[model samples]
Target: MSDPGGRGDTFCGINPEALQGTINSLKRDAGRLRGSATGFKTRFDQLGIDTLPLTKLLHVASWADDQLPMLRRRHHLAVLIDKGADPVLHYPNCPDMIMVDDADVSADPPKVSDVPDGSDPKLNADWWGALTPGMRAELTFLYPDRIGALDGLPSTVRDEANRTALSKEKGQLNAKLNKLRKDLAATKAIPPSNVDDVGGAIGGDPAYELQNKIDAVQSKLSGIAAVEQGLAKGDHGGFPHAYLLGFDTHKLGHAIVSFGDPDTADDTVTYVPGLGSKLAGAEGDISRASALWQSSNQQAPNKHVASIYWLGYDAPQLAANSHGADVASESDANAGAPLLRRFTQGLTAARAVSSPVHTVVLGHSYGSLVTGRAAVHGKGKLADDLIFVGSPGVGVDRASDLHVDPSHVWAGANSHDPVPDLPGPDPFEDLGGNASSFGTNPASTAFGGHVFQADQDPSNSFSSVDLDAHSSYWDSHSESLDNLAKITVGDYGDVTEAPQIPSDVPTSPTLVGPGVL
Candidate 1:
């Protein structure tokens, strides 16, 4: 309220009347902004854009509406969305990003038959959010009708409406997208049973609420887009920024990242998430938030492992109560290959970083799905060891089904875990089966003749407990950890049991939870 460093004749005024007028003008602007936001939302719903992740869409819309009258960026964006004002025409630096089509995914047997080919937002937003703003306008262009419909509106109205709507929808979409993603990731987090001690030296599983921290980061550093751009450009030096590499059916991308340098550490760890993965999804798990990084940090402190969490596509969002072993292999394995591909690339990149990269790829539940995808695709074999914990299937019904050299593979499952018990269908695409011909407990299955180090978490006793075994790999003194550490250090993981995979008729939900992973 201090006179704002008043200049005698230069001030915009100190009169009560002037102040009142300024306030009234601001109110008018606010009202205009509010009205504009409302109308744009309707238009956005029409386009099937998720109101959640579309924050930028809305902001730009509002901005354009306010400025198109005076010709600003929004004004330009409106011209692009409405008048075919080619985005490339103006920016000339949009990088020619072609949004990938969501349809390319090989369709699975209809989980529900009344399908409309691809994901239906009102129905599927629970799994796949609406397309991204970039994809909406310039990339995918799902709403051709809407795009054509704009021709009916005049430039002034069109620009205002388009700007307002795009900004509003984009803003809302991002919000909803983040929330959905958080809930989805949280849903998959199966807490390690023993609350007492974990990771040997790491203490009680390091607590990191991944979403809260990542959200805080983007809020402070730059929005998701900025961070994504930096990663694409390799600009953020070791900050562990989030990225959605490429889309499959949803915006989920299998992610690969370098977490630390060998000059700094003696070991490395790769963490995989459960069903419904996203580029940032796995890392966002509350219990596992930067979970791998914790292991890297503890491994001799400054010396650390450059870890990557496999979050790229693996399967569709799961049902409220479904397990990976119960889902379709095509959905699980196909999407997973990219994640493996990226991991291998990251591994190669790690090697070039002037540090000896001792690597371990660890799978939990569908994480094992991704690892197997890599193995089947003939990749990820360069790692020190292969570990599967709380697994449903790793592309094989027994240890010999995998492509890796037998000595490097191993398995560990948590107590009373349900994942290992989920049904595997006949003529299965993955490795495990319950056929007595192969012979073994249903839960101990691992494809490709890989050996298991020892009984997982010897502290816990009791065989299968539903499908929980899908992610029990990290459960207490669970024997999987021993080999995980050994693998991280590049010592050959000693596998003793030459077990076979067990298969069962799938009675589990086909697709559950928020669709992703």
Candidate 2:
């Protein structure tokens, strides 16, 4: 019997270390056999003798080559299971007890109903660990949508499931788009005088409604294309393999793309974007994550870093769209807080045990508010560090309120970035005194967090705020990006600090300008 409690021993009736050893031995043997077969074939050809036997041997070697990867995958799955389990189960190496084949592995698999709710990351991890390799594969293949979005699953597994789901969704959206186009064409063909005005009277113009549907479908297709483009760049130019951890076309859309495998990384940064962030515009966000990864890797060349572009929440829009939330309000952030907290917890849960990760949660613009809410309301610490850049506020008056050490909380904003100057909600409604819409300005001295230099592309004129400064934090060769990378890799000593904004000074143009009272 194998000792599951011992390292390099069997777990869940599978010996991953043993499987790895077998795979290595088989590979070596296969290589030697192929070499011998080639030599034999050469000798046979020289003597004008048939080389069919040697060719068959070579074919057998090729078959082994194909099967080795599957066996190796099983080995990896077993290791993951062992790591996640509290007391790993072991079994004898007897033929009857061993999982010798896919059929044996799948036999009497656990029910999907046994899986815990996605809300609890620890339970989700345990449930996933209990399943055999074949059972997990079967479930992923059968229900890609559910598996792709499930918390506490491996990034590689979720990537595979999401890719399948993305393909199916793309096909469905394309079909729907085609039908809507046909409907639009048919509606347009009708004579204006003969067409019924009932739709217009009850709702809106039929043609206009059809056009809106077509536009929405087209937007979804574009978002899918963006995701595909991101995935296509696999480990090129120092950027790690892109993983589509989750995605959906509902409402303004949602996507979570990671530039590296978070589970195995030494450092991981999850970035959340703010207003006007939707699936269609996810390409920019994805690129930002990639940039962050590159910068962080450069800062800590030895440490493996993963940067995630997390647009998992339905961000509010500046103008009312199909989704009605306003960017000026905290409703969207309030709704996204729990989801963000769960995702961070899931990342922690699914991470490999041997390699502990230093997690950083970075939120930009309105996303800082969401991050703040998540940190404040969560039962435990949401991340090792929290970074807020170009933010109006973080839904909290002080850095300590975010459930992390004040020193670990960092904030940055360009001097000309107007968003940070926006007035928060009125603390005393009866007095009609206003403040930041979300809460206190996180970069202010009163907030008690380290303020970092992010004043890239400063506005030439002090009278007007530079709107472009708000989006330039992740720009190439920027101080802000460098500081962010430093913070992400836990190189706190190297981070450059910035002068904090005074709490009493009203910086907004509507209140008091830079030179004004």
Give one clash count per candidate, in the order shown. 73, 7
lDDT of 1 by residue, 245-357 (tens): 22221233333333443223456566666665544443344224243444334433545454544454544556676643345555656666654655444334323236466
TM-score per candidate, in order?
A: 0.43, 0.74
Model 1's lDDT to the true fold? 0.43
What is the TM-score of candidate 1? Answer: 0.43
* Candidate 2, residue 288: how far the Cα is off, in Å: 0.8
CA lDDT of each candidate? 0.43, 0.78
> What is the lDDT, from 0 to 100, of the residue 377 in candidate 1?
68
Cα lDDT for residue 12, candidate 1: 19
Top model number, TM-score = 2
lDDT string for model 2 (1-517, tens) is: 2443453644335566678888998999899999999999999999999999899999999998987866776665456445432234445444322332345343444455645568788788888887655567657765778888888988888888898899999999999999998888887543455446663312266777887888888989999888777766657875779989998888978899998889899999999998888888888889899999989989999998889999989887764333222456788899999999989888988887686789999999889999999998757788999999988788888889998999999998777677777655564521222245577778878788999998774433344566666787998888999999999999999999997666565444433122110
The 10-residue segment of model 2 with minimum total lDDT is 508-517
